[model samples]
Target: MTSLVDLLHHPLRWRITQLLIGRSLTTRELAELLPDVATTTLYRQVGVLVKAGVLMVSDEHQVRGAVERTYTLNAQAGDADNAEVDHDKLRTMFTVFVAGIGGHLDQYLTRATIDPLADGISFRQTALNLSDEEFTEFITAYGELLARYADKPDTADRTRRMLSTLIVPD
Candidate 1:
């Protein structure tokens, strides 16, 4: 549990876990999603998570003469019931995680030749209410769905990209 807590304490590790919540990605692919971070730095963070058993190298392939390892989150390492985690530390970690993503997107939009205005990409949020049992059922089903596709191979033809999902009760 200490390993889990340490892995979650790092801002970069937290962001990586969030990005891989329901998906697996190579270090290069993760770097692409988090353009603000140096690839080497991302690789080092990944190594720490891997050592901590919070992440595992699910696949490996040679790309452009370099070997790339794809990682997936270890479900057993993260506990929704762990009371040892410091809320304040988690909050600070999450803030940096969100800011890193936001900064990357902002810089990409500002400097890239492609116009986001012309493109159809967008962000959205929604809310829903559920009873206690219903919420539990929903969470169980969601976890099952994520587990089903967590080991899939990364394909060039797929139109899908990594997406972040946050469920907060109000």
Candidate 2:
């Protein structure tokens, strides 16, 4: 857990992790997605995460004149229940990270050739009630669904196809 915290301490590293959460992206692709960051700096941070076991090289291929390595997060690197850490701080960081990405995407789409509204892009919030057992079941089922499509070539495209689910206790 300490290692996870250490790895996530850097804002850029946390942004990288957030971007790669459920997708595999090559360094070049990540650089393009995160335009504010320098390519070399992003690559170095990715390498550190890879060496630290928080990320693994999911694919490697020679493209043009160089090798492009895609990475995925490693699930075994952190404990889900670390008692000593402040959960609120972690949650706040993640919330900010997510908001930043959303803001960037919105700005990019507005300036680029794409029309997000016409494309049906949206973000939403909802409330739900469930027993602890029901919540656990929902999480397990969702994990299975994510795993089932984890390796599909079109998985990334599917991810962009409109969806965000957040479950909060009420």
Candidate 3:
């Protein structure tokens, strides 16, 4: 359990797992999708995931004396769904998740083209004061809403979007 939780501790690994959830991708494809990460580092992270059993090679073929492999995430392993997830570990996971989102947005913004509204790029913060019971209800509702459509199969008409959420009480 600890190993599973720790496997996603790295920002890159967590992002890789996120990208692989509900999808299969080759190492080269991942590198192209996440051009911000160096080619060598991306390959190393993919290897880590493969060794940890979080990701398995779904396809392999020999072409021009090179083996091309594609990977897919093990069932629910890419998600931080351990029964032993404590507050501290949860915080660590959330921190890593947020950092990865921030990094990706930062990298994307570096491109010469800038169009936040057209792309629907939005960020906002609000303070919610709720009693313990209300807070629990809020969390449950949020989780249910996210889960309802989180695993919708990727389709040509649908575009990939990143959504990260954080909840903290003062």
List lDDT for all candidates, in order: 0.74, 0.74, 0.83
Residue 158 in candidate 3, Cα distance off native in Å: 4.8
List CA RMSD, all candidates. Answer: 4.9, 4.0, 3.7
lDDT by residue for model 2 over 1-170, one digit each (tens)? 24566567677887788777667888888999889998789889998888888899888888898888889898886655355458876686467656656755755566558766877767777665777898799789988998786656654455454245565566
lDDT of candidate 3?
0.83
Q: C-alpha displacement of 18 in model 2, angstroms?
A: 3.4
- Candidate 1's residue-wise lDDT over 80-167, tens digit each? 5366548775665566657756745764678548666655456788787899999999989988998787557657965343445677
Per-residue lDDT over 54-167 for candidate 3, one digit per residue giving the tens place of the 0 to 100 score: 999999988799999999989866454677778887888777777778876986698799898887788888899899999999999998998898889889988677787777
Which residue pairs in candidate 3 have backbone atoms (N, alpha carbon, C) closer than 3 angstroms, thus clashing?
none
Number of the top lDDT candidate: 3
Evaluated with TM-score, which candidate comes out highest? 3
| TM-score for each of the candidates | 0.57, 0.66, 0.70
Comparison by TM-score, 2 against 3, better one: 3
Q: List where candidate 3 sits over 4 angstroms from the true fold.
A: 36-38, 78-81, 124-158, 166-170
Kindly report which residue pairs in candidate 1 clash with one another.
none
lDDT of 3 at 129: 89
